[model samples]
Target: MAVQEHLIESQDRAAMIDPFVQLAFLNDAIDDLTAANLDLLDAEWFARYARSVDELTARLDAISIEARHRGHDRHCGFFSTKAWIKHHVQLTGSDAHGRIQTMRMFDLLPTWAAAARSGEVGVAQTRLMARVAANPRVHVGLLKCVESLLVDAIVLPYDEFERRIRDFQRSADQTGAETQARLNHAARDAMMRQKADGSWILWATFGSLQGAQVNEVLAHFIQAEWETDWAEARNRCGDDATLSDLQRSEPQRRADAAAAVFLAAASAPGDRRAPLPTLNIVIDDTTAEVIVSGGRLDAARYNKMICHTQNGDPIDCSEAAAIALWGHIRRVVRDASGVVIDMGRRSRLFTGAARQAVLLLSDRCLWPGCDRPNRNCEADHSLGWKAHGNTVPWNGGTMCRAHNRLKETGNFSARRQANGSWTIHDNDGEPIG
Candidate 1:
């Protein structure tokens, strides 16, 4: 029966062979095939080998330094360090580094390393074993136990492999959340690869909230000017109060108040864009404050705040006149019609010279973990716009289109309080509360 089994597994003599692959496998398997015994290399003996390896590595490094002594001119680019190793060392990039690290790991752990080296399993599996064996800190910390539990992972059935990993993590007190976070951080890669050619469009689905947060932060940093995006706003809020601090500084604080009054005076809450009007508010040395109502205010309830001018004098008026004036202020408060607004279109509009006011209200993106500019985001109705959301920037916010979709579709939601701030939530109908 044994003879029959051997004959059944024997290769066909007529089959073609690749000398390169055969040599590669032999070389790859040698370390694993070697047993760990004092006779082979005790501490003293291995010390000599270590010295030799170090000297050889130093010589190789010197060669690299000499080659780059001068600024690179591409004259000998093909003869660079990698090319030299591939040609003379006869090793691929992946193989070379892996071999070096694996050998180091093996030498550092004799018994466990030798078992892995001696074909207890294949290269990938053995490599994992070597990793667990060599790291004393991790070994002591229980991560090493994963190796014994997941031995021969390369050959293990998928179900078995999964079971072992879970078993190992659970028994070892390792949490999936922690493992996933590490993987994401280590492997995270994002780039606007084609944007170097100058195109203003990008599209990709974010697989996690972490990814979306990263994108938000990056968007603000990439802009040519300080954009009122959620990311920038968050950055501003940290350690420094950002725009709030800047606008409220001793030199600029009064203007902040004036801007608020101007915003409040100009905001027409109901039928938002009733009539577009421009008014500049100024109060020198005295404290000034304004509030721009983004949505329709129940005027009968909150009429006292807006009807007052910069001097704090109330404008006594007919309900009809107040209603008309309210609409005009709304349009002028946010000139963009809640669409494409280039504050740069009239630099003065954003500049202190024009002394124009932005809708001074909630300042940041409502998205959790998102500190972005309100300006860059879409003016989304916390409630659906079609469902009675007025087209006023006061009722609006600057949110990226991405968050806008999430808000609109109920994947995310926000509710602005009567006090003009907001609370946000994620897709599961769970408030980020």
Candidate 2:
């Protein structure tokens, strides 16, 4: 309650010098709580504690919105308030954005904000309501219905409440719901990135039509694999294996089938973006070892050669060997001084293989926090080619069309650092993270 009072006071003092100083007080309060005997608390005590914390969070959300309104975030040297919250509060980017968005919706719907403050509607449920309220096409009458339910009910399961809200949306405006579904479909994407420990993670989202097609293909492969597994199980167990015992877990089977689908698709000829699959590696000649992107190849890693991707995710030699099966290798020769002597280059603007190389190297748009894939980006000279910049590996990076225009308008400047990172400056000469 004292912390909630402090948060309310902070709003009136929005011009307070060094907003980060208030953050330090909040951190100290959190540390004090962490040092308390939370685990020893009983169930009822824990429930009450959680409720109080949720109320505190709601109040802080209001204060955060007020702070943003007064431009305190910018004065604190942050590019955006969301970025500031991510760094100072230690919340993930998505979580910070969600909090901001929820508060904005609360400002629009006062009744829901009051309910959240009173702990009638929970923090999670409030956020969900905020999301539903964000749909511009949803009639105000639907929100009024939700608000009345919140004010009258003691407690409603969040899932059921969400369903009721959706029912309202569908009944009130089926056309809008269909149009929103189409918009969501247009945002489908996939990402493959390696982790720090040499393993890879794949994340993907698909539209309804595309997802149905993929599911159909995966089902065919799954059935085939399932039958093979079943036969093997029966052979090994003779009389013991049951129908359930014959099959692998659904997730494992699906993973295997997906890999099969991809490998088969790769081998099959079709229209493609890049002519060949390629893996880029930096290696040191002296120790016959792989070199990391930034650090020189001379650095020792447990007295053995080490390798990693441009993003600094480690990989072993065997993995590189596996990739070579699908892709041809290109060599970069260096002189005795460890300077690259030849990289197979020609034109002023990177095209074909060269453009592909830049895309693969950058992985995404060079603009900070702009996750637009390199496939959607245009190759740009980090140093203007008109100013004598060469079309070489070290001089070229990928920029999405929007960011490229910002560069052309002199609002942003970018340069490749020796460590392979891009140094970007805003119009005011401030560095953006």
Candidate 3:
């Protein structure tokens, strides 16, 4: 009976190899599978296909490991299993390396290997487990325990699975996690390249902690910009027209917000590469220092000494006092009409206190979905000077160059509304879409 079972197993294995008996047969099989009626496949079919592929990948990895252990790579004139896999399978160096790492994980924990072969876990989830198991900081026994927990975690969503693994690792060894984090932080790098087409692309890798902080700042600006759509709705007195106002997608908002953060940081006084705006603290001569509206100190209580920038960002009173003591100060006085009565400087273009006043009122680029801080924007006339527009605060609005160009080319228009907010219009005279 045992001899008959061995013969059946051998025949089964031979039949599996029969279809891929040659390179042509394998290539034709792949082509045939690709040409199958994939559009008719349901979600269940997709899930099963994905799981089957993962299982096949595990079997391939096991075969590769066995071949390497048996010195087949040397016979094939390859220096390493990675090189062999890359040459034969057309995988990238990183993919080949990851395959070897997976094989190592399988060798260290047979249960994980079994689970991977059974399609109980996916390739990505298996990779995550492999990384955790291979952490030199984790003891062998602890990894065994982790490997077991991951068997249950295999059913979790990908993100949740990663989080659970991280939590487990952190709980098992806090010091090791910190050390790994430091290593990861040390590996961080950023590169910005301007393409020949005058477009810039940024590539960056950040440690988890810094990445979280960056995400928070981006989210804050994204949310702020998103909220402005509703603010416009309120300005329009809850008109149904605003249901589709300012059609920037969420991804675009996040991208613009990321750029705004970098611009904000570069505008700091300590950064001397460019002439950026300083924190303007408008104050009265009252020695008691009762706070008035405007500058960084707007809406502060008379008893308390909170200060603000012209753009209405709060600053520490000490920082405000230091700026007051030494920074360039140009007094800007506004009349009851809310027009700048005194700009303390004169130019064809709005500059100095006049520019600051416009920036303060505008708060951000007049362009919809642009959350660029006022300081980074240029002051522009909503109506062109050639069209009889003045350089006064009332005539001027804040805008980044891209939007200003649109207005210049007659593709965009901004009209001051009754409530002090500007109503942006497209070239067709429709509200900004």
Candidate 4:
């Protein structure tokens, strides 16, 4: 380890340009492809080159692993082994960790690895294939068959490949995993798809549903709300203060929480909806009207854009901005596009730089015991956001929904001191600094 570290330090000390540029160049070189030639090419060529690299790299990795496992001792057998790679490359703790993991996936599954290397499959399709097929050999077969149809499979985006892989798995018809290999390998796309605006058409469900099954249900729920008059839903709430108030107040305050995720198998447009995850911030129909008319309460100003004039007008602001300023919740937000690149914090006094730093510090969520990725992770103010807890990165940490809820519901408390490191406490009062 020490020798490897020294070798990396010497390499870093040597003059070099940008890491990003270097990575891009190296990625191009591996495929026997060059950017110089790409200047005159079409999109298809890019796909082909990517496919080539995927195939070449996968083959190299498999060979490298076979060599190492055959050559090395019991511990640290593969070059792509994350800890080994990170130690050898001297990567930042996070980049080193992530690359190591991704590479290991290629190493662990030979068939998918070969398919990836052959540029015969898209990453998303490959990932789904890996999950559904579950065996190295099967994945390899999938790659061979799937790649045969496309000019450059590597260039194909993940989303585009999802349905195709499913079709192949089902033999182009609706069926369960065709074989044990398919069952062992297939993984559902866990991410909810997004549009340029924060509003997502997500597939929502609870209780172990997968793919379009959940989304079809959500399409029904959203349709139900949009199609029916609000009178029934609201009246039910009004008749009982608790239930009525619950729907009106909580739902209004918590519209972002209500923004359901779509995980449907069929990407084709459909009509269905799912019951919303409730936050219990009920608003009376009159209150909804008042808030939309510019009631100065934080919820009014915040969700005015999320909520409406009781007449269902679109609240012209980004749902993120509306939720951030008024909802008293720090939302995990995607740029007007639907991926959570940054916590929607520009309006809350935190800059993008700070958000980046927090993400880096935590890598994912910092709930101590959780491993949610950055997309589900939020930038949490060590102190409460409204309690004059500055939105500066120094006062924040990347935390996922579960822990963020911990902070919000007061199950945990965070203290940021003069030096800016945070100390968090649990229900039993043990402190984690």
Q: Which candidate wins on TM-score?
A: 3
Candidate 1 per-residue lDDT, tens place, 1-433, comes to: 9988776566543255665786588567655545435368876677766655444343333222223222223376644444554455677886544544555555554543444434343444444544444434334433334344434354454333443333333223223323454565466554434566675333434322334333333443343233333345566676434455442333343334434443555674766453333321211111111112222222122211222222122222122123334443222222112222333322312333221232233234566556455434444555645556544434444455567666767667777666555667767666663
TM-score of each: 0.23, 0.37, 0.46, 0.27
Q: Give the CA lDDT, 0 to 100, for residue 368 in model 3.
A: 65
**What do the candidate models score in CA lDDT, each in turn?**
0.41, 0.60, 0.61, 0.45
Whichever of 1 and 3 has more lDDT, that candidate is 3
List candidate 4 stretches off by more than 4 Å: 1-83, 86-146, 149-157, 170-214, 223-433
| Model 3 lDDT tens row, 1-433 | 9999999999998888743356577568779887888778787787788667666676555554444443437776888878887787778998887877777778877787787666566767878777777765555444446555555457555644564455455534545544666776789999999999999898888765445345446656776776666677567765454445655766776778788788878777784653333334533243114222222221112222213344434333333444455544332323334565344224568876677677766556877667666655788877767677777888788998667877878767888776566778877898863
Indicate the TM-score of model 1.
0.23
Q: What lDDT tens digits, residue by residue, belong to model 4 across residues 1-433?
A: 9999999988887656575786688777756654366767686777776666666555554343332222223354544444554455566777554444444555555555666555455544544544545434344344446434233235433432443343343332212222322443254443567789885554433321122233334444554443233455556655433333433443433333234332332553566553343211222233244334643222212211122111111122222133434654233322222122344434574456565545544334655445555534667777666776666655677777667876778778776556333567977777753
- What C-alpha lDDT does candidate 3 achieve relative to the native structure? 0.61
- How are the candidates ranked when ordered by lDDT, highest leading? 3, 2, 4, 1
Comparison by TM-score, 3 against 4, better one:
3
In the range 178-247, model 2's lDDT, one tens digit per residue, is 4555665689998999999997777888753345345546666876787688788889887577767865
Cα displacement (angstroms), candidate 2, residue 314, comes to 40
Residue 394, candidate 1: alpha-carbon lDDT: 42
The best candidate in terms of lDDT: 3
